[model samples]
Target: MKHLTETEIADWVTGLHTPAILRHVEDCPECRERARTLASALQLFRESAREWADNRTPPVRMIPARRPKPWAVRWAVPAVALALLVSVPVYDSYRRDRQARAETALAARQAAEEAEDAALLSQVDTGVSRAVPAPLEPLVSLVSWNSGSWNASAGQ
Candidate 1:
């Protein structure tokens, strides 16, 4: 049988022993002695640590949590109500100011759009009022066909 490794010995201390470990430890005297020595050393260390904690460490005092004063609790609701009452008129004033600014912005935008529409209509009216386009005026004098000689209704 193979002897338990240093890690296996540690695992035994931590209660991680398998059936194989049990059988080996029972059968192997050398391994059993080694396990006992390691266990004894750990127990001594644990005892010393507990002794140090008990003797050397300072005691901790837990301070109780502070409660709110009765007067503060009594006035809390009225204070909140007063705050809400004061805030209502201020909030309404802010809302009206914002609405007025938005209305002004909308009116300005509408006036600009009306001006643009009027300018476009004036340009269209100028174009429509002309008898012929300026570019086509030069071509009009070149035509020899008189209006009385030709008719669109007859092919001739």
Candidate 2:
């Protein structure tokens, strides 16, 4: 008798074979053992598939939430405002002190210049008040001679 092919055995194991191949498998011990092994492996695979499908869970995705600012950052605006409010008057006072010093320096320089001018004018007045001696008076007159005095001196 011809033995059953592996395809016939597989088909018989899955209940897809004709009655003739099934009869051959029933009579053939070797083919019966192969069919029995294939059936048992297929049953095991179906049980594993059912367990996996029933117990599987879908993946979860997490989204991040927005957090509030820290305490220091929240108070930074008021701190800066307080600093500006405290600094404005101090800066104004510093500017006014600087301007006063400059004006005092300028007034002192003007007073010194006026004192020097007054001293020079006093020296000029003293020089103009002093007179030459009598012997030098004739020499002074000759130096002041005009054209008439020049002609008279030429005749002499």
Candidate 3:
């Protein structure tokens, strides 16, 4: 007769063996002793595990307190204030430069328009003055008999 293996004995201890293995164990003395030993060991382990699970307790934990920040780290606010104070004047100067450029452009445009008007007026005055020469003065006075300079009442 062949002897049962350790796995067959473990299966028999756990009551999971087939009918053939069970019959073999019943007839074989060596296999029967092995199955008995394995069963007793498994029973002892299960009892110990149950007792440990029932009697176990959770462990306690502790948390530490927070510390304050250093002095140099707290100086960030004043440093930012000083940066703003320095940049304000530079920004204002840039704005004033842009305004001055706009005003200069406006003045130059007005001066060019005034010069164009003066040139036009001079052309008109020159044309009108040249239209009446010195040789036509007497003919102009005779045609303008009703003029105040040649009054008929003054002759009377």
Candidate 4:
């Protein structure tokens, strides 16, 4: 007679085995070992599920949705804009001063970089000029020429 397999034994453990399969396992050592393995696995699964349940947090409910007050909105926008307008000129002046300082700092940095570049270029023995063109020179010259012409016309 063929002995019951592990699957048949697990079905027996779960009370789902056929009567013929149960009878076969009752006489088999291999089937008994399989049944014991299934029982241990089931116990481990139960312990893990219990631990998960113990550690899990229930979700939060009940958040009140906030609505803005009309008066607050009416005052807040213009007040903020007016504050911005008054402070912006001062801020812009401060920013312009900061920008001037930053430009001066950047110019110093660029001068140092150019000096290094020039030193490196000198070391390479390539007589090519790699210096970038100054963009502000033409505009300054144009303004000076217009002012001179206006002054000459004014004297006439």
Q: Write the per-residue lDDT of candidate 3 for residues 1-156, one digit (tens) a residue.
A: 899999999878766678989999999998999889888888898778767766767522323434345465478788889899999999999999999999999999999999999999998887778746767865665553654565444346
Best by TM-score: 1
Query: Residues 121-156, candidate 2, lDDT per residue (tens digit)?
Result: 998887676565656766665454665654345335
lDDT of 1 by residue, 1-156 (tens): 689999888767666677788788889999999999999999999777667666754833335545667699789999999999999999999999999999999999999999999999999999999877989877656654566673433333
- Model 4, 87-106: lDDT tens per residue? 98999899999999999999
Name the runs in model 1 displaced over 4 angstroms: 1-61, 136-156
Which scores better on lDDT, 1 or 2? 1
> How much lDDT does each candidate structure score?
0.82, 0.80, 0.80, 0.73
**Model 3 lDDT, residue 137, Cα:** 65
Clashes counted in candidate 4 amount to 0
Candidate 2, which segments miss by more than 4 Å at Cα? 1-69, 133-156
Poorly placed runs, candidate 4 (over 4 Å) = 59-156
